[model samples]
Target: MNTTTTEAVPLWRRAAAELLGAGLLVTVVVGSGIAASRLSPGDVGLQLLENSIATALGLTVLILIFQPVSGAHLNPVVTLADRALGARHGGGEIAVYAGAQIVGGIGGALLANLMFAVPAALSVTDRAAPGQVLGEVVATAGLILTIFALARTGRAALVAPAVGAYIGAAYWFTSSTSFANPAVTIGRIFTDTFAGIAPTSALWFLAAQVVGAVVGVGLVFLLFPNRKAQP
Candidate 1:
C-alpha cells in the first residue's frame, strides 16, 4: 500500500518527513486542545468536541501531505506496526523513525505552549487507572487494525480519512480519550494544559499501547494471512 519504495527516496529524507509530520500532528493536537479549553471555559464537553474535530481534520491533512514520503506514521506504534507487518524497514530505520517522531513530538508540544503564552511545564494531570489503561489498549488496537486493514486490502488511498474518522470517534468511545500514540503521549507530558498527561501516567499508556500493537498485529495476520494481500 505504501507506494514509496526505499530506493525511490533516501531513508534520511523519509526520516525527515516523519519528524516533520509527527511534529505538526502534535502541534495540531496540543494547540487545538489549548484553544478548546480557553474558548469553552467550563464546558468540558464542548472543549472535547472542538479538540476532537481539529485533531481529526489536522491528522487527515498531515497524512495526505506525508504519506508518499514516509507513510505518514506520526505515531511510534504505527511505525513499529508497519515494520512488523513487513513494510521493508530495517531495525536501524525503525529506530531512526521512532526517535525522530519522539523528538519532533516534544518540539511540537513546546511550540504549542509558546504559542499559547503558557510556560512549558510538566503536566500534573494523572491518568494512571485500570479503566484508562484498558481504554488505551482498545484505542491503539483499533488504530492499528484500521490502518492495516485498509493497507492490506489495497485501499491505502482511504487511509488518511479513515484513520482520522476512527480517531475522532474513538475520542468519545474510549475513556482515555484515545491517546493511542506513544509519541503524542510523551509530547503531551511537556504541556501542563488540558491535554497533558503526567509522566507516571505516560508510562502506563506507552506500555498499554505496546500490548495493543501486538494484539492488532496478531489480528491482522489472522485476518489477512496471504502475502499476496499485502501491497
Candidate 2:
C-alpha cells in the first residue's frame, strides 16, 4: 500500500545534461590544446603538460556536475558498456546518449576554433603510425577499466577524480595522447591543432577504441565477477 516517492529524471533533462557536459568537455580539451600550443610554441613537452592538466581538471568538474542527471557518460563507449553489462536498460537510451554526445562534441570543436580566432579547419595531423595505434588501444582499455572497476567496487563516487587522473597520466604515457572517447576523437578532426587528429586517423583510432572497450569489459568481469556493473 506504500507509494514510491522518487521519480526518475525526465529523458529530456537527462539528454540536455549529456549535451551540455559533453560539449563543455570537448571545449576544454580543444581550447586547452590551442592555448597550450600557442603558449609553448617551442616546447612540445610543455604544451602537453598544459593540455593534460586542463583536460583533467575540466573532466573532473564535468563528471561531478552531470553525474546525477545521466550518469555522466560523456562517451559512447561508456554508454555502450553500461548497456552491455545491464547497468543501464534500453537501446533507446544508448542511441539518445550517443547522439547527444556526438552533436555536442562537434559543436564544441567549432566553438573552440571560433574562440581562438582560427577559421574552422579539419586536422592535418596524421596519427596513423603503428605505435600510435598501439597507444590508443592501451589508453582506451585503461580508461574503461578505470571507470568500471571503481563503479563495480562500490567506489562510484571516486570515478570523477580517478578518471581525470587516469586520463592525465595516459596523456604522458600514450604516444597518441589518449584520445579515448569516440565522440571526442571525432570532434578533434574538425580542428587542426595540437590535439587534433586527421579524419582518416580518427577512423583507425575509433576501431582501436572499440576493441579496447571489449577488452576492458572482459577485464571487468574477470576482476569483479560478483559485482553488478553500476556505472
Candidate 3:
C-alpha cells in the first residue's frame, strides 16, 4: 500500500469511487453531445466537431482535477491492467473500479436521455458494424496504450486532454466510433439515447476493446520500456 490508491481501499469502496466519478463524466459527455446534436439541427459534422472539442476539454479537466484523488482511471480496463501489471497496484481495487465505471456510464446515459427527451428508442442498439468495430479496436487500442504510457512515465501532467483528444478524434475517425472507455460503453447500454448501445452488441465491442488494450500495452513496453521501479 504505497498510496491510498494502493492499499487503503476495499474493492467495493474503490468501485464506489470509480463509479461516482465515471457517472459524472458520462453525464457531462453525453449531455453535451445531445445538446450539440440538438443545436446543430442539420449539420451533424459541425455539431459533432463541437461535441468533440468540448468533450476533450472536459475530459482533460476532469482527469487533471481528479488524478490526485482516484488516479482517474475512469475506464475499468485501464484500472485493471494497470494495477495487475503496471502502476499503483491495489488489492480489490480493480473490481471496484470496473464496477463503478459501468454503473456510472449508465447513470450518465440516463441523464442524457432525460435531458434530450429522447423518443421511445428503449435501446441505443447502434453497435459498430463489422467495419466500424475494426476502427474501434484500433482507436481504443491507441487510447489505452497512450494513457498507460503517460501515466507510468510520470507524464500524467500532460493528461489534460489526453483521453479527451483521443476520444474526440476516435469519435470522428473510427467506424465503431471509438468506444474508448469500457465503462462508458456499458453505461450507454441503459438507454437508446445519443451514446447508447444495444445490449446484444455491447459484449462484442467490449471484447474487442479488451484485446485492443492488451495490444496497446505490449506496444508501449516495446517502444518505451519502463524504468526500474525506485527503492
Candidate 4:
C-alpha cells in the first residue's frame, strides 16, 4: 500500500520485506489461477472467481503481515506513487524496492510453476488487445487511487482490505482481469499456466500501468490536495 511512515526501518530490511511480500502475493495469484483451472475445468467464470477470491484474501493477509516492517508496497506502481506523493523515499530506495519486488515476483512465479508441476516456460497467452490495454489503464488507475486515497485521509488501516476488495472486483470488472501491479504482471510472464501473460503483451500492460499511475496521482492531487500531516 503506502510506505511513507516506514522511514525508521532500515532500507535493506524494508527491501527484504518488499521482496517477500511481492513474492508471496504473486504466489497467491499465479498459484490460485493454476488451481482454479484444475478445480473448475471448463468454466472460465468459476476459475476466475476462485482465483480472484484467493488473491484478494491472500493479499490482505500479506499486507497485514508485512506493512509494519516495509509498508508492504509490493507493487512498483505503488512504490513510485509513494515517492510521487512525497513519501520521504529517495530515488535509490525506490530503485531498491522496485528491484526487490521484480525479483521476488519472478521467483514467485517460478515457485508457483514448480508447485503445480508445470514446466517453467514463458507464457504464450497474448493479452495485447486494445480492450485489454484499456482495462489495464483503468485497473492501475483505480488501484493507485484506492491506496493513496486512504493513506492521505489517515485511513491507512483500511488500505489492506480496501485494496484487496478493489482488486478482487476489478478482476471481474476489467477485461484484463486486473493485473494492476507491474511486478505481478512481469512475474506472470514466467509461467505458461492460466495466469501467465506473453512477454510481448506485458510491454503494453506495463506502459498502460505507468500512464495509469500518472493519472491516478493527478486524481489524488485533485481530490485530496492537502495531505494530512502524520503525527
In candidate 4, residue 179 scores what lDDT? 95
Which candidate has the highest lDDT of all? 4
Tens-place lDDT per residue, model 2, 49-102, is 999999999999999888888888889988887666556447787788899999
Local accuracy of candidate 1 as per-residue lDDT tens digits, 46-105: 999999999999999999999888878888888888888887777898899899899989
- Per-model TM-score versus the true fold: 0.96, 0.94, 0.86, 0.98
RMSD in order of candidates: 1.6, 4.2, 3.2, 0.8
Over 4 Å off, model 1:
1-7, 227-231
Worst window of 10 by summed lDDT in candidate 3: 1-10
Please list all clashing residue pairs in model 4, or write none if there are none. Answer: none
Please give the ranking of all candidate structures by lDDT, highest first, separated by commas: 4, 1, 2, 3
Q: What is the lDDT of residue 23 in candidate 3?
A: 82
Candidate achieving higher TM-score, 1 or 2 = 1
> Candidate 2 at residue 225, lDDT?
70
Candidate 3 structure, TM-score to reference: 0.86
Q: Backbone clash tally for model 3?
A: 10
Whole-model lDDT, candidate 2? 0.85
* lDDT (0 to 1) per candidate: 0.88, 0.85, 0.70, 0.93
- Return whichever of 2 and 4 wins on lDDT: 4
